[model samples]
Target: MNKPEKIVAEDLSEAVTYPPEAFISREYAEAEPDKLWSKVWQQAGRVEELKAVGDYITYNICHDSILIVRDTPETLKAYHNVCTHRGRRLVGNNTGGGPKTVAQDKGAHSARGSQMKFGCNYHAWTFDLAGDAIYIPDKEDWQGALDNVCTSLTPVQVDTWGGWIWINMDLDAGPLREWLEPVASLIDPFEFEKMRYRFRYWGIFDCNWKVALEAFLEPYHVQGTHPQLIKYGDFYSFSKAFGFHGQTGFDSKAHRDAGTAVETSVHRAAGDGDPRTTIAQMQAEYWETIGASTSETLVKTAQRLPLELPEGTPAGEVHQYWMKIAKEADAARGVTWPDLSDAQVAAAGLALSIFPNVNFIPGPTFSLAYRVRPWGTDPDKCIFEAVALDRFGEGEEPETEWTFVEQDLDKWPYVIAQDISNMVEMQRGYKSRGFKGNLPNPWQERKVTNLHRGLAHFMGTGHLKRID
Candidate 1:
């Protein structure tokens, strides 16, 4: 009897090395829409983006366009953005016009609509915020034929978590919270829903979406990519998998004690030895470079460390005093801090990723979030975006818009621009015969490999035979 030889996977990621083809193969890029993106829940925009009842935003992933609208204060609805009449995109990606040499003080609006309903710019097929096909210009001529066809925009699953609107095309997939799991449970105490966007920027990059995303998934690259930042204590961090999602956290005494999961210090916690000057210096560097992880309140409080604490104060005590002062300062400004317990406060990361492509660095009062999308079927292109979020008093939230800057990386805040500069070159290097696949730091990059392991689950991975 003849039997088929079973195939096995040669996951380089499992061996702390990333298979280069995923970043360089068109076939892999083409399969992702069906094998990955469509099956997962991805963030579209913040709940705040749809403040007014009729406000709507368009999120594009691969070839699919999703329209998300705020139907009412309590309801949000999502639909395929194509017009039912002629299949023309009902919305355009209005990621155009912004400064080149440097970033601007404000962001402009994304493809958005505020009317009670949307009219297809092509044929004027109008659909209400609920995606109900309200008007057909020549309904009488079409007769009952339209009945069989979905006259209404096809409904897509939509949900809100952590103040972000998410869309899922797979009707069979679980609810957003269900998929979120321990990752959400770990971060829920940070109360991300209370934060609003303070900075927004997106641009196309000559790299795979996963490549762009992997840049933020771990802090292991800090030494090579950000040498200047080494002066700020240590960027020491490790990664842990939470089912499909992953988190990278800084080295902590607590983790060392229990030998378990730890999170990156977005707060840039005080290090060993005297804490007075070191903690304040770390806070200032964060403010000057990325400008989001530590809030202005925390940065201001850190500045007082030298005067508030004696020269030889222990790092642990310094952390407590620093937070006490920051919380009081925030309270004075009517800013309500999230009610995080001592344990949760000590172990959250500077970075975490949700399944396919959403990454975030959670902090007490301000944080940074990132999203990456395929720019088409091109294995070498992706849409990269970063956002800054802050918790503010009742009415202090600033008005924000989606800003798209061109290829000039100089405009990005110092540290981010440095990261971007590495992307295009990395993609090019991956194609070279001399370059081997990526070797990730085992413990620190478990989060990066999880992305690959997840793809293999849906796509069914197999490996090539080795040479003798």
Candidate 2:
């Protein structure tokens, strides 16, 4: 893959102005279903979730509910979740087996087999996997009423790419692969389909969907939002746009500098002792303060680094050693690490923003993926879902469920919690009378600008002109 050319903030000649009301207006939120959400292909669920012929999952976006089902060993289908008879929802649970009835229920009968079918709880209207109306009561009541009506469940366009099931409500919408564009090609080598979800979390935030989505698109917030990370790497980032999407790459110079500076400081403070010995002692104290031992990866990586290095050893030597340790660790876990270039390995932790609603923090062995969507019609509240995926050897995939985190927000991982801490307050600030439109840092926030520009294009707003 080609590395993205870094562009400085001052060199960007165009500025995409975003109005403040876009983040807080109910009318704008209401218009999204038709203008944006309906027209775009959105990820419905992971392909692994519906492996069996009868397995199915329901994905709800705003007021739209879609039922995605695995109809055969190789065929998957998606349909509107509403029963045609009375518009009642066909599936109430997030995921479950096909329609069946227990013998103990008063009005229930058994259609108990592996072939999944959807039975509306309201009137027991049954639809086959293909979404054809299979059974309905009182068939003679209105004999001609069903003659001209297309009673079968309405199917939305469905496709799969990168092991994800994507659905678009607009039947005329472009193909999924075409919509994904450069992002699809950029990440194709990672073999994301081989990864399984380690955990899935959902939280309701008092902020716009864009506000929540934008939080992960850039690393500039690291210095203020996550000060602890500064010691590990530089907060300065390089960003590049790909029309509808963009990515941010971090420079690790500060981390290398810190290693050497710490060594010198420790040597000076400890008098004539070997500098390596002094540095080792300092590392022990620092790790204790940060509680690094509690994290298995941190502990393993720390153990591999020499506690005492030669006085003139370059920090690159330490980084090379850590990479060696990482490879060994993966080998022990039965994982075959991908063949990646030096630049690709360096950018393993880069954050990428896919236009509309998805963002990813890609890693060599694991990745953190996020999806943000408006919750119902409320402009101030949105649903934020996070999924952590890890590469596992064959037959070792984890069995996980969507765990809602809003009830106990404190349970979220530290970095994620820190990012979330700023969201609610930021949303409140947007409603303040004194605030004006957003003023994004041209280079650091270019991804945010690219995202809004995509939104404008989809919403029929004027095209954002880029001044050469």
User: Could you estimate the TM-score for every candidate?
Assistant: 0.89, 0.81
Candidate 2 to truth, TM: 0.81
lDDT of each: 0.76, 0.66
- Model 2's lDDT to the true fold? 0.66
Q: Model 2: per-residue lDDT, tens digit, 269-386?
A: 1223433333344345433442221223424554545553445554545444545566677778787666654444343336676778898665455567889888776788888888
**lDDT per residue (tens digit) for residues 3-35 in model 1:** 213332333223444467678888887887888
Instruction: Let me know the TM-score candidate 1 reaches against the reference structure.
Output: 0.89
- Positional deviation of 427 in candidate 1, in angstroms? 0.2
**lDDT leader:** 1
Choose the strongest candidate by TM-score. 1
Model 2 steric clash pairs: none
Off by over 4 Å in 2: 1-13, 93-115, 145-149, 251-299, 307-317, 346-349, 407-409, 461-468
